[model samples]
Target: MSGTLALASAIAEMDRDALESLVRRRRPQAPAGVLDPIGLAAELLRPDSILRALSPLDRDALAVLLGLAEEPRAGLARDTDTRTAERVSALLALGLLGVEDARPVALPEVTNALRHALMTAGHRPDDLSTPPPSRSGDNASAPPAAPPSADSWVTAALTAVGQTAECLRVLRDRPARLNRSGSVAVASVRGMAESIGIEADHAAQALAAADRAGLVASGGSSLVVSERAEEWTESDHIARWLDLAATTLATIPAPLRAGLVREEPLAAIAAGLPERFPLLSEAESTAARRFVVAAEYLGLSSHGRLSSVAELLHSGERAAAERLVRDLLPPAAPGVYVQPDLSVIVPGPLAPADEIDLAALTVPEHIGVASTRRVTEASIAEAFSRGITPHQARAAFARVSLTGIPQPLDYLIGSLAERVGNIQVSEHHGDDGRTRIVVGSSELADTLTVDRALQHLQLHRVDPTTLCSRLRADHVLAALADARYHASSPRARASAKAATESTAPPRAQDAHDDLPEALSDLVERVFLAARSEPGTSNFTRRLELAIRDRVPVRVTAEARGQQHTFLLLPVSLSGGRLRATDQAAGVERTLPVNLITAVESA
Candidate 1:
C-alpha cells in the first residue's frame, strides 16, 4: 500500500465539494510539502529523488491510505479487517501517512513529493504550487568545487524569471495568492499564461512552486511578493529582456527592419530580444541610431520624403539618389527636399539652385487638391412667398456663371433638379482649369446632401469628386430623393406648390398638369399636405397615401446627361393598369393599388 493510493481512496469516498472544502480548510499559510500534491509527485519521480528509494505500492495499499486520510476519525478500528490494516500499515511505512497521537494525518513531505511527481507527469495539481527555481546560488563568487556549465547560470536566471520577462512581471504583480492545496485555478492562471505562450495548468504549477519559494505570497484577493522574499527579486530582469529584444531585432531581415522598429523607441526595441542578448552593456547612442534607422526603414518616421527615398533605394539609382540628397538636405521642416537612398537634403531656403537637378527626382503617381463651391436651394413655398419664379432662379444661377457641370457635383445637382422642373447645373472653369459645379435648388436639401457626403469622405482622405467617381451617381441621387421625399409632409408639399405657382409663369401651370399622376402623387405625398376637407383634396391625399404605403417607388429613369432619375415602380407592373394621358410621358402605367408594397414620399 502506498500513501498516494491511500489518499486517493480517502478523497474518492467524499463528495467532490466536501473533498475540496476539506483541502481548502487544511491549506497552510506558507508553502508546505502537503500544500501541493501534484508538485510533490513530480519531485518524487525525478531520477535521483528520495521517492525512488521506495518500491511501488499495490492499488489495495493506495485505496487503504485514501480511506484513512479522508475519514474524519482517522484510525482503523480494532475490529477492522486484516486486509485493510495491512494496506494501511504499508502506506505508513512509505511515509505517505503518519499516525499523530493515534490519528492518521497526511505527511507534508509526502504530499509535496506527490505534487511534484504529478506535475512532472503532466497531471494537474490539486493545488497551485510554484516549483522552486531549477537552480539557486548565493551571492558569493567562489567557484563551485565542481565547476558549473557556462549555460547553467543563464538557465537558472531564465527559470527564476520564468519563460519570459513578461511572465515574470505578471507573476511579480499577481493580485491574488493562489491556494495550491487544491486543483489549480485554470482561469486565474490562464489570464497570465496566455501572454507568455505557456499552457495555463503548466503556468499555475510553476506559479505554485514560486509561491512555495516565498517569491510570491497570497494576499486573499491578489498575489504579491512576500516581504521576506523581496531580496530574491533583485536580478535585472528588464535588462535581460532588453538584450533578448535586441537580438531579435538583429535577426530580422534588413528590408523588414524599418517597419519593425518604426514608432518604437530604442528602449522599447531592446525589450523584445531573446534571453541570451547582451543588453546591459550596449551604448545608448548606438542603440538610438539603430532604432532610428529601423524606424525610418519601417516607415515609422519621416526620414525625408519617405516615398522618394524608398523609390530611389528600390530603383538603385545612385546618381539620382545623390541629387535628391542635395535637394532634400537637413530633412527639416519648411524645406523643399527630395528623398534619395541614404541621404535627405534641401538645396536652399525656398528654391533649389540650377545645379540641383530636379529632373532626377521621380514624381509620385497621384496628387490631391482641396476645393469648395457654394450651392443654393430655395424652397418653392418660400420662393413663391417672395414672388420668385423657377425661371428667375434659373436666370440667377446663369448670371453667376455657375452653369457648367463638375463630375463630382453631378449627383448633388441632379438630385435637386429632379424635384423642381427648373433647377440648373453650372460649372465655372477657373484659370487653373479646375471646374466648380454649382447647383440651384431649395437651400435646405442642397446643404444637407453636400454636408453629409463631405463628412462621409473625410475619414477616407479623398476629395468629394474622387469619392463620387467610385460610386454610381444614379444610385446616390435615388437614395437622396427617396430620403427627401419621405421626410417631407403632405401639407409641406402643397404649400411648396402653391408658393411656386404664385410666382411661376402661366406655362409653369401647364408643366405641372403634364407631370405623371404617379410622379405627382409621389410629390404630393412627399411635399404636400392632405386637406382635412372632403372632395378633391381628400381623394388626392388618400390616393397618395395608398401608393406611398404599397409600391416600392424609386427614381429609375434618369434625364439625359443627368445623374438624377425620375420616380417609378421598382419592378414593372403586370396585370391591371391605369393610364394618365395628360402627363409629360403621355402614359402612366398603373399598378394594382393593392400590390404596392412600399412608398417613399421622398
Candidate 2:
C-alpha cells in the first residue's frame, strides 16, 4: 500500500478518544472543525509539516524513523521492548509512524523529508564512521550512581556567578567590539580574562554563560552589559545560578542533547552519538564543548558526571531544583575577618550586601578556594573619589567585620576625608576648550604633571594656581582618582556615554515550538472542504501529488448536477483552487477544490 493510504487506514481504526489524544499531543491549535481520520492523515503527510515535526524529536525516535523508511512495512518489529514501544507510540501520535499489518512503520513522506533536511544541514549519514562506544556503559540494568557532594557543586556555582559578574564589570567599563560575525574576538576574551584574573578558558565559558543569561548583549558592533544585569546582580545567589544554568541548557540544540540521561556525563553522551546520526559542524562541536564547560561551572555536573540539580532541571522540576540548590548552598558568613595588615579574609561566602559593598571598597587579592581582598590607602582614596564618604566607608566595614575596624584602616579613611576635596577640577571654556585644574599647591601640581600614572591627562601647567587639560573635566577627574589623588569636580560629573545605543536585553529563544500549529489552519480548510463534498480531502491530496510530481491525472468534477471527467496535466494547487491543463481541450482549467469529486492517476 502507498504511504498515504497506509497511514489513512491506521488512523481510521482509532476511536474518537484516541484520535483526539493524538491530535492534542501534536499541540496544534484546535481546528475550526473536527478532522476525520483521512483528513488528519493527509495533513500530517504534508512535506513542510513533517519536516518541522521531525527536527525536534529525540535521537532514538529519529533513528527508528530512518530505519523504517528504507523498509516501510518490515523495518520495525512488532515485538518491541517497553522503551522501544513507547517511542513507537510517540511517533505514531505525531503521525510520523503508522501501524501496518499489526507492526509500526515509518511514514514515507516524513522519512523522505527528514532525509532532505539532513542533507541540507550537511549531515551525510551514509559516510559517517561507526560511533565509538561510551566508556560508561548505556545498558538499562546498570545501577544508578551516587551524586557528587553538594558542597563542591555549590562552591563551583558561586565561583561561576562571581567570575561572570567580574567579566560584566570589565565589559561595562570598556565594551569589547565584535568581529564581522558578531562574535567576541579571541584577543578581547583573553583581555577580559586577564582583567578578571582567571584562566582564559574559564573566562570564555563565563562570557558564554553571561551572553546566554542575557546579562551581556550585542550592541551593534560591540558587547555591552545589558540593563537586565542590574536586576540579576540584585537577585540572590541561588536565583542568579538558576538563571545561568537554565538559559545555557535551553540554548543547546535538541540534537546535541538527545539520548542524554540523568547521571550520564555530557562528554559520554557527546562521544556515544551514533556515527549515522547527524554530524555536528566544527562550530557546533565547539559550542557542545562550551556547554559542557558551562554545565560544570553552573554546578550542573562534577568531574563530568551529571549532578542531582542537573537532573531536576532537565526534567523541568524547577521548584524542586531551586529548593535543592537552596539547601545545598553553603551558609553565608555573618562577618569577615578584618586584619591589621589591611586584608579581609572571607572565611565563607559573605552576605550579598556585604560582598557587594566590600568589592567596591577594596581590591580583590585572591579568589576561588580562599577569597581575600586588600584595603590600601590608595584603595580608600579611590573609594572616596567615587562619592563614598569616610563615614559610609567606616560603617560598611564595621557592619561586616568580626574584628572591629583596625587603627590603620580607620586612619586611612580619616586622612582621605581631610584631603579628598583639596584637588578640584572644573569645566573651562577659555582659550581652547580646556578643563581647569587646581591643586593644593604648586608642588602638588608639578608632582601631578610629571606623575607617570596621570601622564595620559596631559596636564599643561598654566601658573602656580592652575593647570589645564585638553580632555573633558570628567576625564581628568577620573584619571586623578585612579592615581589615588582624591579629586572632585565642582560641576556635576558628566554621565558616561555607552559605546552603542542601549537596547532591551535579548530574550532566550528556547521555547518549544507549537509543532501542530503549522498544520492547524491547513487541516481546518481541508476539513471544511471535505465536509461539503465527500472524498474532497483524498482528491486534494491526489491533485497535490500530481502537481508536485508533474504527472497527468484523471479528474472527475460536478457542475450544475452533471458529472464530467477530464485528463489534466496538473499545473498548480493554491488558495483552495487547482489549476490544470485539460489535455483533450488543450486549454487551462482552474477548478475550485470543492467542485472536484475525485482525482486519480492517468
Candidate 3:
C-alpha cells in the first residue's frame, strides 16, 4: 500500500492522546515522486488519475485543509506540539504542500478537496470563508456591498448585465463549439469576447460565472443555455446581476475573495498576484482585471468596494427595489453624433440592448465622447441577414443620433441591403434521404450559367426564374459566394432580432424559443467527426504533435520499482527516446517509450 494509505490507517482511529503515542513511534516525510509541488498537483488533477490520496482525512483534519484552501499561496504555519505537527506534516507525504523559503505553501487542489470534504462533513462552505482575523484588515462583521438604488450607475450596470445575459443566451442556444483539450477555438473565442466586451482569456471566466449562476451549462461539445436561465429572466433584473457578482466574487481566491467590495484599487493584485487558478492564467492578471471591471460595469461595485445597492439587494432590502433602477446604471449619453465618415459617435456607454442593436448594424471602434463607429456595406449586409432591413436599420440609427443619419451611411446601408440576397439558395427534399439545391435569382442566372461554381453542379436551367442542382445547399451557396455573388438562405430565421430595427421581431415571450437541434443536417453524406482522436500515435507522431501544440506532455518511466512521471516539452526525438525539457525541473532529459509506462499530452 502507498505511504498515504499507510498514514491514513495509522491515524484513522487515533484520538488526540492516542495520536501522540502513534506519532511518537514514527514520523516520515512524503515518499519519493511527491517532492515537487506542481508535479504533485498535476498528478492529482490529471484526467487519468482518480485523486484518492486525499480520501482519508476526518472532519477535524479536513477543517485544517479548509483553512489552507482559503488562501493557498499564503498558507499558515501555526505553532504546534509534536503530535499536531506530525498530523499536519502527514499532508506533505501526499505531495499536498511544498516548502518555499522555509515555509509550507498550499496548492490549489487544497481548495477543491476542501470543498468536497466540507460537503462530505455536512458543513456549508461558508464555514471556511471566514479567514484568520489577522490576515484580513476589513471588518469581519459585514462584507462590502454595492451603492444604494438611488445612485445612477447602479441601474445602468444591472441593465448591462441583463443585456449581456440575453446575448449569451443567444450565443449559447446557437451552441458554439470548443476544441479538444477544452480550449475554445481561437476564432470562436475572439467572436464571443468581442460580443461581450471582455478580453479573450476572461471570456472563459465570464462563461463560468454564467454557468455558476445557472445561465449556462456544458452540453456535450458546446455550452447551452440552461432551463434555469429562463428562471433568471423571470427574476428582478438587479437581483440577477447581484447574484452573479456575489458568485463571481466567491471565485476569486482569498484573502481577496472574503470581501470583494473593498474600496482599494486591486492594481497590486493584478500586477503581482501569484495564486494559481484552474482556468485563468497569470498574464497581467487578466482574470482579476476582467472580474473587477465586469463587476464595476454591472454596478455591483462602485469606486473600489461593493456598492450599497448591491449589499441592500443581497440582504433582501426590498423597500426601494422598484425605484432603485433609475440611477442604477450610468445614464446613457443623451444622443449619438452622426458623422460624414459613415460613423455614428456615441458620447457615453450605450445600454446593453442598444449596444447589441447597434452592433448588429455598425462596428464600434472608439469609446470617447461621441465614440466613433463605422457603418459599412459588410456590416449592413450582416445586419440584413439578422433581419434588419436597410431602411429600418438606418431609421434606428437616426433615432439614436440626434444629428440624423449621414448621406454616406444611408447610401451604404441601401447598397448592402440590395446586395445581400441577390442570389438566393433553398433546399429541395429528395428520395433516398438526400437533398438538392434550388438556386434562383434573375440577377444570378447569367453569372450562374458561366460560373465555375455552377460548373460542378451541372445545373439544368428550366426557366429564367430558377435552376435546380444535385449539389447540396451549403456547397452551392458557398460556391456562389466564392464567385463574389451574395448568396442567402431563405432558411435563415431572424426571430431573435430586436423590433427597433426589424419588422418581424418575435414577440417578447417567444423570442428565446424553438431552437432546432439539427439545422444543417440535410446532405447526402453525414460523416461524424470526432472531437478528439484516439491515442494511436507513435513516437514520431507524438513528437510532431508536441511540436505543433507546444504544450507539456506527461512522460512516465520506471526506476527502482516506482513509476515516475515527468512533464516535458518535447524538443526533438533522439537517442531512441524523446529529448525534452522538463518544465518543472527546467532541465533537459530523454524519455524512452519501451520502459515508459505512459506518455500523453498534459
> For every model shown, what is its TM-score relative to the native structure?
0.17, 0.73, 0.46
lDDT over C-alpha atoms for residue 177 of model 2: 74
lDDT of 2: 0.71
Model 3 regions more than 4 Å off: 1-174, 178-187, 194-198, 225-299, 302-304, 318-325, 331-335, 349-356, 366-372, 429-465, 490-602
Better of 2 and 3 by lDDT: 2
lDDT of 3 by residue, 438-550 (tens): 33345546556676755876776656757777778788778766765566676643322211122221122221243222211210011111011221133344444465446
Q: Write the per-residue lDDT of candidate 2 for residues 35-142, one digit (tens) a residue.
A: 544556666677766766765564566666776776554545633567767877777766777765566777777777877877887665443223433455577688
Write candidate 1's Cα lDDT for 509-549 as tens digits: 22113444433333233121211222122112223322333
Residue range with the least summed lDDT across 10 consecutive positions in model 2: 492-501
Residue 220 error for model 1, in Å?
A: 2.5
Model 3 is weakest, by summed lDDT over 10 consecutive residues, at 522-531
**Candidate 1 wrongly placed segments (more than 4 Å):** 1-168, 171-174, 177-184, 196-202, 235-602
List the global CA lDDT of all models: 0.34, 0.71, 0.51
lDDT of 3: 0.51
Cα deviation at 275, candidate 3, in Å, is 15
CA lDDT for candidate 1: 0.34
